[model samples]
Target: MTITVILGAQWGDEGKGKLVDGQCQEAQLCARAAGGNNAGHLVRVNGVSYSFHLLPSGLINPTCLNFIGSGVVFHVPSFFSELAELEAKGLSAVHDRILVSDRVNVLLDLHVAVDGLEERELGDAAIGTTRRGIGPCYQTSRARTGIKMTDVFYPDLFEQKVRRLADGYQKRFGELFEYDIEAELARFNEYRETLPKYVVDGVSFMRSAQESNANIVIEGANALMLDADYGSYPFVTSSSTTLAGIIGGLTLNPKNITETVGVVKAYTTRVGAGAFKTEDTEEIGTKLQEIGREWGTSTRRRRRCGWLDLVVVKYSNSINYYTSLNLTKLDVLDTFETIKIAIAYTIGGEELDSYPADLNILNQAEVVYHEMPGWQKPTTNARTYDDLPKEARDYVEYIEKFVGVKIKYIGTGPDRDAMIQRP
Candidate 1:
């Protein structure tokens, strides 16, 4: 295949890093198309764990080239910090192996300060952002006033842009936040000195890669429910998290996209504030959280856990047109004697077949669940589809039938090898 996409079908933490890492060996290139350091992906190989916010997980494969597409908001501090951490883990050629899009917007110190102030302004109604300045940077980029990666290479332009943005922020926030322009300029200049080797025209590179017929994998950040257009309002992340985001970010031909793998947890978990229609809030939620380690990779905040919602998955399938589904954390559901899956939403007096975009309707909607029996046995070592216990197999089949997509990959554990692949 020339291009295969691995996307988070549920909320952000769907173990996409491991899924993308597993296929990196087959890909000639792996590119991250959207989001920023606000999203985190964890990949484990040979007993060592690798976590990435800006860099592609394919960095684990020394031979596979990686790119950060223009759709991403580039955070310089996080970028260099993550690269150094990966180098310490023995991936020493990272500086040469990766390419960053020159068109990507730069995340500045002022943006982070503004983000903190904005969240504080929200008070109890905060969106629970990671405070990495992703949203503010994106807002600036859309306004056509933000500094780009290319601009930072020129000292004069970089300084002017920094001062301009800092003055605007200082005027808006008053004493609530400080904008240190000189310090920021110094740090950015140092970054510009080191970033030259990694910079490239991402759109042109992707086009050339296609012409060369090189196999590529697009790794998506965040997930469908967090998408700006389709997700719950105000609580949603700032960027596109669906397939359209991939195409827009990379400037890729949609016809070149072969397989779109939608990764979802066996149940459901979401970080930050939003309307969780199926949230457990009780013992089942606690057990699932404890077993699944439902915590944010970037924020480390405990995610709100709930039962699998076919209503949500079915909605995601319609948007992405996934070729297959990668069901992760199934083993987390192994302890439950009885597990629930949300089949539809009960709104007021009537049941709805489709997910509603309105925050008010969704928040008021009740989950109509279908109960299933758990396998209660470990599946972490299962190597084949048939190796799974009968109850476990049934749960997978139930999700498949309901979502109208094949469950081709079953993640029984966190390790790269702890999965059953169905043909």
Candidate 2:
């Protein structure tokens, strides 16, 4: 059972889409293990760029079977829209190879409404949600009142579930925000009817495939730093965004995993608000952002750019048990006069090599940086690591040494062929 897991190691927006698509070429099955439409994976193939939400990166490859595992919260509109876009691109046959987990929860229109309302109410205390109803949907799932894709197959059950959730939310809305629930439910039912057709039982299907020795690639959303449990606390996502999430999300054993590849950008970039140890405020940071196009795929919000934080990378490496690393966007730093990498963190006068569990400590921590000369020569034309300038190679080596992981793949450009495989 050669199962490979690919995920971001930063606060997301780490170019996971390209890495997963590249890896999917070698695997038979590629599965999206977590997150909802709130997470977006952008892939540039043959000069055309495709932005996907609620679809596995593998969908671009017609030969691979893509599975949406139980870990995700389904958003029908976004899923169908993405599918249609892919179809418009002449990849309509992809639907035949994709499957969704029956156990995955569905994100209803009301959930989106309620989530947005709640975030607005929170004001400054809000966790900087995408307002895509991801948090609310997961909350409902844990509350044992969520609607699954299977529920859509049964009209009576689906209606009953919707009514129950709507009734409860309506009462809370009045008490919490003085909003009318009856009107919201009426509108939600109308929207629900327009949802796409989906079958459940993804866990069983994946398990059977595993028994048959199918090569499965578990694609993860977000990154370790955005995980609800271990990430920058209160600012993290609603779900577990780590490799451990796959065990519960897919009901799979850790023993069945063959390899896990953690994807990290050459530098770091994060969306929303959180503790960014290596965040750059100077001209160099702006250059990286522009060159890398560091922006959120779901919200199109400009990302907060920063230098490489080895402290967080090492933390992710330990938690995800990453066997290999796919370092992307290496060419983004080619034109800079110098590149700075955060080697460690100094918290309360003590130099720490690892991330602190306490957000307070993290917020106050000072980064110990190491500056390396940037390569003036262009790397966009370099197809291999050997072809890259010496300074660029040094920067890569610095990251590999500090993070304690081998750089297996380096992305020089946005194109699929722009990736360089390290020897």
> How big is the positional error of residue 106 in model 1, measured in Å on the Cα after superposition?
0.6
Per-model TM-score, in order, reads 0.98, 0.93
RMSD (Å) of each candidate, 1 decimal: 1.1, 2.5
What lDDT score belongs to each candidate, Candidate 1 first? 0.88, 0.82
Clashing pairs in 1: none
Model 1: per-residue Cα lDDT over 1-423, one tens digit each: 479999988877989988898889888899999899988998888888888998999999988999999999998898989999999988859888899998999888788999999999999999988898989999999898899998988899888888888888878889987777788888976887788999998889988988776889899999998999887667888999999999999998999888999998889899988888788899988988998888877888999999998888899888999999999988888778898899989877699868897767887887888998888888876889888899999999999988889998889888889888899
Q: What is the lDDT of residue 248 in candidate 2?
A: 76
